[model samples]
Target: MNIQGHAALVTGGGSGLGEATARELARLGAKVAVLDLNLENAQRVAADIGGVAVQCNVSDPDSMQAAIQQAAAAHGPARILMQIAGIGTAKRVVGKDGNAAPLDDFARVININLIGTYNAARLFAAACAKLEPMEDGERGVMVFTASVAAYDGQVGQQAYSASKAGVVGMTLPMARDLAQHGIRVCTIAPGLFMTPLMRTLPEPVQQSLAASIPFPSRLGKPEEFAQLATHIVTNTHLNGETIRLDGALRMAPR
Candidate 1:
């Protein structure tokens, strides 16, 4: 699918990977909608990219419905959807808190990461399906973000791992389902990247995490992730697969 003049929606567009992707898409002639939980930050990124900003709670169906409608209003319909709105979990499923880690929290991670991805994908596909097919009979494509933890989650990542795993599980099925409509789906499992999620760590701690990588031995730049995402959007052959963005380093259990 050509990104030029396409309507693109990027969840978690406020910072990190999503923001970088949005910027890249905008630079490539796509009109982007920056959707995030943080209204101010979303607005800032949208302003910077000359796109619309939408405040969306991806975990909530109602919120996503309204936001998707708004995106349609602002930029026609989003034929390119990037699912990056997700939360990180550090608590165990059963913790030392006597009671097990709250089930709601665990469910929430699934809701935001997995269900949220579904919400955006469904909405984007529905809108795209209404449009005429492109040169290759491609209606649209969606790119989702997962984590390496889905495969090798450390001790405290039970909830996070489970949720991201669900994302991985869905990629192939989703692509098959959307095939008739000429839509495609793919997932990206990123390794240690310098995203806003990890920015909370101390600078030294951040360095340590980067140093742990094997070959490149450094954290991934957000722009690097964006570059891959851009390639996926532009390439019609890539679909129904999960690509790892980690730099040849497997994670050690924490």
Candidate 2:
């Protein structure tokens, strides 16, 4: 579907992949809404792109509804929904000391990453379902964010891995479920990307992580992620698949 003049909503748009996507969509002439937990960052990006910024908590239904309503009020119902809001907490299910991991930590990750994606996607689909179809009965598109850990989880990543794995697990079913509604669903499992979270680590650690990749030997850029997202939105045939953005890297068990 053509993105020009369409309403698009991007979660976690304050920074990283979501920020890059919002910029790209705006460049393509889409009316974009930047949603993030950090209102200041969201507002900054929104201002730069001439879009609306919504302070949103993807995990909370009411919060997401408010954010979506705010976006819709400004740009109309979002025909494109990009879910990038997620959190990672590193903790071993069984630590070296043999203590069991806290259940609340796992629940928190699941709530933010897995449930949050689902919550926003459902609302996006609901809103888009009401709109008239474009060509070939296509109404909308949804792109979700998953991590490489979902498939090859390392140590100290039980909660994070499980959360991402749920995202990966939902791709085909979601696509199938929404197919009747002329909505498409897909996922991107990014490898080591140089996101804001990654920037927090020491330079040496970052370099080590970069070197671990088989080729290109560097982290993926946020723009690269945005590029794929744009392609997914414009390309009509792509759906129900989880594409790995990793640079030929299969994460080793740490």
Candidate 3:
């Protein structure tokens, strides 16, 4: 489907991959809506791209509905929904404290990453289903963000891994279920990327992680991820798949 003049909604569009995708979509003439928990940063990106900014919590149904309404009001119902808002907290299931990690911590990650994706995808699809189908009977596309952790999580990442795994697990089923509506679903399981969060780590640690990749050893640029997103949006045949954006890296257990 052509991105030009279509409405695109990107959660976590304040920074990192979502921000990059939003910028790219706008560059391609899509009407972009930048949604993030950080309204200030979302506003900055939205202003930069001449798009709409909405403060959203993907985990809450009401919050997501409000955000979707705000974006649709500005740019019409989104035909491209990018789910990227997620959080990861490193805590061993059995920490040095000799206790299992708090269940609330686990729930928080799942709520934000897994359930949040579902909330946004469902609402976006509902809106798209009402629209007239585009050429090739296409109505919309959804690109979800997963993690390499979902498949090969090291220690101290039980909750994070489980949440991401749920995302990976849902890709095909979601795609199949939405096929009848002319909506496509796919997931990107990114490895270590030089996101703002990763940049905060010590240089040595960052370098070590980069070195772990087999070849072209470096962190992935957010633009590279955005490039893939653009391709997925345009490539009509691509659906129900999880593509790994890693540089030949298979993480070892810590």
| Candidate 3 wrongly placed segments (more than 4 Å) | none
In model 1, how large is the Cα lDDT of residue 94? 66
Of candidates 2 and 1, the better by lDDT: 2
Q: Looking at model 2, report the run of 10 residues with the lowest lDDT sum.
A: 88-97
Error of 2 at 184 (Å): 0.3
Q: By lDDT, is 1 or 3 better? A: 3
Clashing pairs in 3: none
**Model 1: per-residue Cα lDDT at residue 75:** 91
Cα miss at 52, model 3 (Å)?
0.6
Candidate 2 structure quality by residue, lDDT tens digits, 1-254? 89999999999999999999999999999999999999999999999999999999999999999999999999988999999999988888788899998899999999999999999999888989998988989999999999999999998998899999999999999999999999999999999998999999999999999999998899999999999998999999999999999999999998
Residue lDDT tens for model 1, 62-137: 8888888899899987889889989997886666866678878888888899888888788778878888999789
List where candidate 2 sits over 4 angstroms from the true fold: none
Model 3, position 111: C-alpha lDDT score: 96
- State the TM-score for model 1: 0.96
TM-score for each prediction? Answer: 0.96, 0.98, 0.99
Q: lDDT score, residue 88, model 1?
A: 90
Itemize residue pairs with steric clashes in candidate 1: none
